[model samples]
Target: MIRWTSSRALPSVDDVILLAGFGLGLSLIVAIGAQNAFVLRQGVRREHVGVVVAVCAASDAVLYIVGGAGLGALVEAHPGFVTAARWAGAVVVIAYGALAARRALRGGEELVAATDGAVPDAGRRLRPVLLTALALTWLNPHVYLDTVVLQGALAASYGDDRWWFTAGAVLSSVVWFVALGYGARSAAPLLRRPGAWRVVDGVIALVMVAVAVSLVAGA
Candidate 1:
């Protein structure tokens, strides 16, 4: 996955493991969640996009590093942490979902691209945005259940090349977050119409509530 193979240089078995990690990580992280929805909203607003993307990518990289380093085992041993996170995540996600639903119903929100003739909305202060991003990432139980636990178990299947697998997964996180955040920014202009923005918010609301429901049901 890192590079194409040539006749002179065949790919090693570990390379295959790395590629597997990259593919699996991307597939898992791309799922709809409160965090991803918030990232997209912030991206559309062009508010702290760089910081949000960095926080997400760096957090995922940390999870992958720890997952491969036995932190997964520790997390598994303590079920209470997961339980608490699940409840907390559900609460926060539900609240966010309700807010999004209200905005969608009200239909006042509209996108203003930086390229627009007038100044675009600057959005909220940096501190609140930063805190919200952090909370959405760390408080979510999926970060532990799906990422650390499930991915770590899969990484173990690589045996001696587990770290390579972890590295590839980490790379996927960085690439996905960068693409999602900046990609949304590029599409901000498409949401200039209030109707389009309302649709985006409605979609985000559904995703957030869906995630919350999943967490509650699983718990």
Candidate 2:
């Protein structure tokens, strides 16, 4: 009988750093589900984009660390954890969907135009972005899997030196959120028109509803 021993292969320094960061960042974000849309909307408004990004990045960092620390195993093992997350996520998504439906139901005539020189309502500016960001982060199961389980698992793939991988992943989250928040700001010109704002709001509502439906269906 021939016995085969598994050799632990370590990823190259460059590869580990790049892959870990890229994987973590992309996993947490890069999806046009609920969060990204909200962020983009806020960015266009030039209101509280920084706050939204900060919250999102911070949330990701915490969750990623917890997941990397093997907390994901607990989530996976405990049926209650999944149940709670799913229910919580479902409720959040539904709420967003309802908001979107309301916007969609409102005709284009009622839409506000985005004018660069004109000031926006302060309350409107902050509430939507913050609420959307929170909903995206809290409601989506994929977000957990991406940051916590998947990112952590990727970091752990480095055998013994998993910290290096995790560092890269964490960095990616920061960079991506900052970029996303800032990038959205650049589109303010296009988003500021009343018609444009209405359209954007309508789209957001549709996406929210669709995502909510998906969550319920999956559940």
Candidate 3:
């Protein structure tokens, strides 16, 4: 084997910072929350999966950039912003949970079953999906705490290397959302029956309610 060991062969400072950013970003994002619950549901339903994924990925990227640019530090100073977000997020999640509970009560065929035996797009409308996706990503206080505050602080620690960290974080976010939304298709086979959808909606409702409680408690 040829010996290629050298300082140049080792990871550079920027490379290390990038990986650190990516690792930290993934660690924070992988936690399941109401937002994730919604995404998984959309993915399983095969409805607006791409829209959900895109919204999440794009929102994360924008937040990361803002944080990296020092918005995180500013947010830390204004605690009221987080407090407001918490209350709003709690209300939104509670309402969403109720909708989910209703769905769980209603069987799958009944959910989108056509009255006239004609094929109909039973999934939710695109505007509502877009709005909900935006709300989940933006209204959630945890998003600011993790992406803006913590991630921003970490990025600032890199000084001149902050942008590299940001790039890595954005990449990590994109990969995660893509995987979460599309990878859910693998479970499609298991969700073909009305019972399976009920179970899923039930679980999602539970997740939403739990998230609401946590938001209130944290506030």
Candidate 4:
């Protein structure tokens, strides 16, 4: 009556899946970047947050699937890819930094609608979201190393139930984006205040500049 299965030898299946997903989600969410910053800005300004959230979540899901399918190794093998990505990311970070700094220097009312004016038609918005997500997810060798390659490798450690782990990880991105996009709206009141907006934007600018510098140095 002492027969034991592999499942019993380790953590429960659900726990494994949750842990993998939660870890991946948390790791990706920590950094301040264009996509997330944009989302937060939009949320505060009362833009089309649902669509924005959907776009982010959808793009992330697609990339994660590609990674989980084992395409990360290809990215890792290409040093050129990483080098180019770092440069590109640097450009984005610097540009974002400039924008954030401008907003911070200006008053809240001026900054509130800054991002809103930049929105294109529905089609254009979707294009940017997809492209940005792709660049962020694919072009960046780090994403490949972390999400696609490393996460995939870990998921594979589960053998037959790896899919469960993958699903959890994907869900993490979904949940976080939704929460962030929505939660950011709470800052609208403060964002309405010119002084407060300046402070927030100042922080955004600093973060972006730092990221850009780091990228260039690392490259």
Best by TM-score: 1
Candidate 2 per-residue lDDT, tens place, 60-171, comes to: 8787777656834555466455445444545664565565556546634321232234343346666666677788787888778667765565444433444565666677
Against the hidden reference, what TM-scores do the models get? 0.61, 0.53, 0.60, 0.51
Alpha carbon lDDT at 196, candidate 3: 75
Worst 10 residues of 4 by lDDT: 114-123
Regarding TM-score, does 1 or 4 come out ahead?
1
Clashing pairs in 3: none
The lDDT per prediction is 0.70, 0.58, 0.70, 0.59
What TM-score, to 2 decimals, does candidate 2 have?
Answer: 0.53
The stretch of ten residues in a row with the least summed lDDT in candidate 2 is 109-118
What's model 1's overall lDDT?
Answer: 0.70
Per residue, candidate 3 scores C-alpha lDDT tens digits across 153-210 of 5565455567887888899899988886777556444534568767767775776676
TM-score of 1: 0.61
Tens-digit per-residue lDDT, 1-219, candidate 1: 599667687788778667757765765675546787777777766788899999999999988887776743544566455556556656766776787788778886654432344233466688998999899989999788656766665554444566887888898899988887878766656655677757766776776676567557756
State how far residue 58 of model 3 sits from its true place (Å): 0.6
lDDT of 4 by residue, 1-219 (tens): 898667556678577556645554444453445566677665654566677777767766665666556533443565355556557656755765687677667654333442444432333455565455456544666556546655554444444455675777778778877776677656545444678757766765765565456557756
